[model samples]
Target: MFSSKTLAEMDRNIAKYPPEQKQSAVMACLIAAQEEHGWVSPAIIAEVAGILDMPTIAVEEVATFYNMYETKPIGQFKLVICTNLPCQLSHGEEAADYLKKKLGINFNETTSCGTFTLKEGECMGVCGDSPVLLVNNHRMCSFMSHDKIDALLDELKSQAKKGVSA
Candidate 1:
C-alpha cells in the first residue's frame, strides 16, 4: 500500500472531476503508483482500485494489458525496444540483436551494472520512428546501430557518474 500522502494525491486525482467519473483517475492513479514504486505491485494495484472505487480485477486487467506498466522491477535506464510492424519492417530485430549483444543481457533482463533493463515492446505509436528505444523513459533513441548504442551507454554512464559525484 502507498503512504497516506500518495492516497491523498490519488483522492485529489479523482476529485478534479465529478464523483461519477472517478474511473477516469484509474490510469493516472496507476501511473502515480508505478512512478513511486518503479513497478506496479499487486498491493499498489489494489490501492489504486480502492482509490478509483473500482474492482481489483478491473485495475489488474488494465495494468496487465499495458506493456508500459511493469509487473516486475525494472532498472535505472529502461531500454524499451519496438517490435511492432513498422519497427520490425525497418530492422527492429537487428536492433534488438545489437542491443542484446551490447548489453550482455537478453530481453526482459537487467544489465549487471544495473544501468539498464531490456523491454521488448509493441507499437510505441511512433511507427515512423521505427526501431526506437527509450532511455530512462525520457530520452528516445531511434534508428539505432551497435556503435550508436555503445555511445549512448557511455554517455549515460558518464552522466550518472557526474550526478553521483555532484
Candidate 2:
C-alpha cells in the first residue's frame, strides 16, 4: 500500500538491524506506513508484520501504544497538545480550551471539515516551552498563546487552500 520509495525506506530501516532481529525495525516501519496511509489499519498492520516477520498483533500493539500513531482516520492536520503537569501549569489548559472552542471539536475529535484533529498528548520533554503542541507529530509548536493559535489556524487553513502542508 506504499510507493516504491516508501518500501525502499522501510528496507533501509530493516537493514539497520541484524538479519535475525528484523523485528527491531517495526516501529520505524510503522511510522513509514502511517506516513503513507495516514492511519494504521488491520491490513497495513498485517503487511508490516509480514515484512518484518512479526505477529500482526505485535505491530498493532506498537501502533496503539504510541499516541503518535493514528489508528483511525484523521484530518489533514493532527493537533496534539501536551497536557502534562508542567504544561498544564503553564497555560496548556487555556490553550487546549481555546483550540476546542475554535475548532468546535473536543479532544480525540476531528472537525466537520476534516481540516483538523485534536488530541491530548503526554509531556514532550520541553517543560520550559509550555502550552506546546505538535502538528502532524513532526512540527513542534511551542509557547502556544491565543494569538499564536489563531495565526497557526489561519496558516493551516491557507495551506489547505493551496493543497500544501505548513
Candidate 3:
C-alpha cells in the first residue's frame, strides 16, 4: 500500500497517458509505489495493476525484470557497485572487495544493523567512471579509490548516526 501522496503521484503519472492507454504508466506507478514502500510487494504490484487496468502478472513481470526494482526488502542504504568488464579492469573488483571487507558482508548481503546492503551490479553506462557505486539507486560515486571508499563509508555511517537517508 502507498500513502495518499504517492497515490496522487501515481495518478499524475497515469494522467500523462490517454485514458484508454493508462496502462502505459505501469512503470511510473510502480516506481512511485516502490519509493513509498521501499520495495515492490505482491500486494503493491496488484494495486498498481488495478490502478493501471493491467494484469497483476504483467506488473510483476516488469518489477522482476528490472534490477532497479527491489522485489524483496532491502536495507536503508543500498550500495550497488558496478562490476562489468570495463569497470572490473579499472579496480571495480578491488572496490567491491574493499566494501565486503569493510562492511563484513558479501554481495547480496545486508549489514547486521540493517543500515547497508551491498550488491554487485552490471555496467552503470559510465565506463570511464569505473569503480562507480550507486547509493540507494540514485547517488553515483565514481572513481572510488581506497581513500575515497573509506571517506564514503564514513560519510554514510555519519549519515546513519544522524538518522539521515542516503
Instruction: Write down the worst ten-residue block by lDDT for model 2.
Output: 157-166
In order, the Cα lDDT scores of the candidates are 0.81, 0.93, 0.92
Candidate 3: tens digits of C-alpha lDDT, residues 1-166: 6789999999999899899999999889988998888889999999999988898999999999989898998888899999899999999999999999999999999899988999999889999988899999889999999899999999999999998887
In model 1, the Cα lDDT at residue 14 comes to 84
Q: In candidate 3, what residue range of length 10 has the lowest lDDT sum?
A: 30-39
Those runs of model 3 whose alpha carbons end farther than 4 Å from true positions after fitting are: none
Q: What's the TM-score of every candidate structure?
A: 0.83, 0.97, 0.96
Per-candidate clashes, comma-separated:
0, 0, 0
The TM-score of candidate 2 is: 0.97
lDDT of 1 by residue, 62-139 (tens): 999977788888776788898887998998999999889888999999988777799887676787776788775667
Q: Judged by lDDT relative to the true structure, which candidate is superior, 1 or 3?
A: 3
Q: Write the per-residue lDDT of candidate 2 for residues 1-166, one digit (tens) a residue.
A: 8899889999999999999999999999999998888888889999999999999999999999987788999999999999999999999999999999999999999999989999999999999999999999889999999999999999999998888764
Error of 3 at 118 (Å): 0.9
TM-score of 1: 0.83
Query: Which candidate's TM-score is highest?
Result: 2
lDDT of 3: 0.92
